[model samples]
Target: MPLSREKIAATAIRLADAHGLDGLSLRKIAKELGVGPMRLYDYVTNRSELLDLMVDVVYARIADVGQHSEWRSTVLTIAQATREAALEHEWFADLLGGRPHLGPHALAVGEANAAALSEAPAVRGIDDLQRALGALNAFIIGAVRREVTERRTARSAGTDEAAFQASLGPYLTGMLKTGRYPTIARLVIDGAHLNAEETFNHNLALVLDGITSRPRT
Candidate 1:
C-alpha cells in the first residue's frame, strides 16, 4: 500500500524517540520507511509539517483527559501525561512551543483542557480560563524541558543523578569552600528528597493552588 501521513508520522515519532530531534530528517525517515525522500512530500510538505503531525500524534494520546468533571484533576492529569510522553520521547520537549499545533488531536487536547477549566466555578470568565490554561501549559513545558535536559545530561555521563553528583563531589566541594555561592551551598547540603516526580507534583500543586486561590473579580 502507498504510504499515508499517519504512517509517516508514526515512523518519524519512532525515529525521534530513538535518536532525538536532532537526528530526525526527511532522508532518514524515508530510509526507515523504505521510500525515496520525495515520496514523503506526498504526505507532508516538509519537515515542519511532519513535526506538526508528530506533535498531534503525541497529543492524541492525552486528548481524553478533559472528560473529567473536576477542572484541577483534569489539568493535573493532562500535565502528568504530557510529562510522561516527553520522558518517553525526549525530542518532544524541543518541538513543543516551537510552533502552533492546530491538528485535530492537538485541537482536541486543547478543547478538553479548555472545557474542563471553563467548568470551574473559580474560573470567572474566558480571560481567566485562558490565563489558567496558559499557565498550566507553560509550567508543564518548562518543567518537562528541564527534566528532559537533566535526563539527557545523565545519559551522556553514563550515570544516574546521584552517581553523577558523586562524580562532581570533589569539584563541588572545592567550589563550596570559597563561600561565594552560599544559597546554592545551603540547598546542596539541606535540600529534602530530590525526587523528580515528587518535585514535579509539588510544583504542579503550587501552580494549581495559585490558580484556584485567585480571588474572583
Candidate 2:
C-alpha cells in the first residue's frame, strides 16, 4: 500500500506518544510502518516537517472552539481540550509554541478561537479579540507545559508528585529555614494544592476573569 502524508503523520504521533519526542525518528517510524526509511522522505521532507505534521494532527483533535455559545465557555473548552491533548500525548506540551503550526487544522482551530472571542460583548475590535486569544493561548500552553513537566519528572523518579516532594523535604526544610524565600517557604509549609486538574482549572478561571474584566478601550 502507498503511504500518505496523513498516515505518516498519524504513525509518527503514535510513535511519539509511545516513545516520547526524543525517542521518535524517521527510522523508527519507517520500521514501525514496515517501510524503508528513505520512503518517508517521499511524504515528509525531513524530521522538522514531520514534527510540524504531528503537531497539526494533535491540534486537529481539539473540538471546534466556535461551537460553544459563549466566548468564555469557548475559551475554557479550548483550554481544557488543549490540556487533555497534552496529557494524552506527553510530547505535545514541549512541541507546542515551539514553532508556528500553519497547517490546515491548526489554522482552523485558531480561526475558531478568534471567532468565538470576536463574538464576545466585551471584545471591541479585531485587536482586542486577537489579544484575548493570544493571552488565553499563552496561559494554557504555559500551564500545561508546567503540568506535563512535573508529571514527567515524577514518572522518571519512580513516584508521584507528593512522594517526590516528600523526598525533597529535608532539602526544602533546610532552604526554608534560611528564610531567603519567604513566600515560597510559606507555600511549602502551608501546603499547596498538588492536584494538576484543580490547579489548571483555578488558574484558567483567573486568566478568563482577567480577560473578561479588562475594560474595552
Per lDDT, the best of the predicted structures is: 1
How far off is residue 10 in model 1, in Å?
1.3
Q: Which pairs clash (backbone N, Cα, C closer than 3 Å) in model 1?
A: none
Task: Look at candidate 2 and give me any clashing residue pairs.
Answer: none
| Number of residue pairs clashing in candidate 2, backbone atoms closer than 3 angstroms, sequence gap of 3 or more or interchain | 0
**What is the alpha-carbon lDDT of model 1 when measured against the actual structure?**
0.86
Clashes of 1: 0
Query: What TM-score does candidate 2 get on C-alpha atoms?
Result: 0.92
RMSD of each: 1.6, 1.7
Error of 1 at 207 (Å): 0.6
- Please give, for residues 39-62, the per-residue lDDT of candidate 2 as tens digits: 999989989999989888888888
* Model 2 lDDT, residue 97, Cα: 82
Assess candidate 1 and give its TM-score to the true structure: 0.93
TM-score of each: 0.93, 0.92
CA lDDT of every candidate: 0.86, 0.85
